[model samples]
Target: ETLTIKTASKTYPLYIGKGIRFQIQSFIQALEREFSSVLIITDSIVEPLYLKEIESSLTDFSNVYSYVVPAGEEAKSFSVFYDILTFALEKELDRKALVIALGGGVVGDLAGFVAATYMRGIAFIQMPTTLLAHDSSVGGKVAINHPLGKNMIGAFYQPEAVVYDIEMLSTLPEEQWRSGFAEVIKHALIWDKPFYDWLQAEIHTLADLRDEKLQFALAKGITVKAEVVAEDEKESGIRSYLNFGHTLAHAIEAGLGYGKMSHGDAVAIGMLFAIRVSEEYYGIDLELQKFRKWFRQFHYPEIPKHLDAASLLQLMKKDKKAQSGTIRMVLMKQIGEVETVKVEDELILSILEKELEEVQQ
Candidate 1:
């Protein structure tokens, strides 16, 4: 399936299916610009699995090259970013060169950032391999992690196109599937109640994710993201709705240490906490227990013991959404409805303390 993402920066196509990765040459041919060289930025885990396929497709391009970073979130670091820039310089990749992000969100962010800043911006494509990447790959938000926070340094640079080969996801472990689906769930929670209900009715086991339902879910999630981006590029308005669970999710990732917990897992817990906060702050019934039951069935875990409320609160203050020392978060008014609100520190701390005590008991 093909979806056109119309952003103020550019209008691009997102090609989704089983074998689209093999059609890299055809997709590149469809682009208006030609490149002097092609640099593919991938991770170690994906190098052995699908690098040759992409390379084979680009045999017509004599200047094609590849760089392999570590397999996880650690790949999104300033050091790795610098190393990639050095590699690009050494290879003599010019401003007219193209970049291909050939892995998950980490690779996408790192490569996109490289393409964005390299010689003042070059064209790049997002070829996402993992399920979780569906959300990250669609949005142009690219960045590396900072010791202070996740995605702390980044830009709103759109890609030339997104080539999502769902077939490549077969190699992902069960946990990866669960992790990736968190974003899909988030999309449903904040934009489409029908999609949320569809998921609840259709998905019962992790294996269910491998079926046709996966494509439908991805398309729905990506479309939701595309429409939002088209309407509000650079996250100046409703774009922040996409960060529904991300405030606490980012904090969890940073608190636990990057790559220690999967982004999807952190997001799952973050969504739960957001719902809890919404219930209290809004004084409305969000059906929190039902949501908790669904999440637990998928084995989404609780907040780790070591990540204290005080420390997480401090970390959350560093979140991009936070402003003037006030922690602003996307809260649910209802499924498919949300708004950014400045949550008080005391309420957050109290909720954290109360929730942690319940979990421990």
Candidate 2:
């Protein structure tokens, strides 16, 4: 199946199915009649497993080269970004070339940035292999990491297409599923009440998420994201709602060090905190106990007991949603309803401390 993501700048097809990566060569050939080269940027973990299959599919296309970066959040760094640019230049890639981001969010973000800035931008494709990537691959936002913040350096450069082969997910570890499902939950919470109820009732374990169930959830999540992006592409308005749990999520990732915690896992914790804050300040009624129980069933790691509220707050100040020293968090008025609000530092600190204390208890 295919979904079209309509952004302010352009529209692109997100193709979802089994074994779709094998058809990428024909898709690329059909999309661009004449291209100079095709660069397949992947990661170490994915390279051994699926790179050769993708490379084989592109054998008919000439000047196809592969570049592999380390398989983790660290790959989304200035050094790696520069290295990819250098490699592309050394391989004689130009504006006519196409960049294929062939892994999860890290590869997508890094390679998309390389494509966006390399010689004033070029065409690129998203070949996402992970569940978490279902969100990142479709959105036009691309970036590399800075020391202080996550996704701090980036651009709104959409891809030529997104080829999501769900077959590739068969090899994903359980931890990866845990990581990806958090976004699925986030998507449901922010947009689809029915989906949220369905997930809560039907999905109880990793095994429950396989096959048709997994595909439906991914597509539903992607559809929610696409609709939001269509309405507000550059995050100047309603698009911020898509970041429902990301403000604290990004802080946790940066505070613990990138890759120390999976993005989805951190976001799961952040969602709980957002819900709690909503209950406390916005007078929203969310069943904290039931949500925590559901989260535990999914094996989302507990928020670390050692993380201090003050330190996390310091990191949160660097969040993209922050404005003039105040943090703007996306809080839910109800499931499927959310808004961004400017939260005071002390109240945030108080909530953080109370939440951590509860988790400890």
The local distance difference test score of each candidate is 0.91, 0.90
Clashing pairs in 2: none
lDDT of 1 by residue, 14-118 (tens): 999988898999999999687899999999999999999999999669999999999987889999999999999999899999999999999999999999999
Residue 140 displacement in candidate 1 (angstroms): 1.2
Q: Model 2 off-target regions past 4 Å?
A: none
**Alpha carbon deviation, residue 92, candidate 2 (Å):** 1.9
Query: lDDT of model 1 at residue 137?
Result: 92
lDDT value, candidate 2, whole model: 0.90
- Clashes in each model (backbone N, CA, C under 3 Å)? 0, 0
lDDT of 1: 0.91
Please report how far candidate 2 places residue 81 from its true position, in Å: 2.3
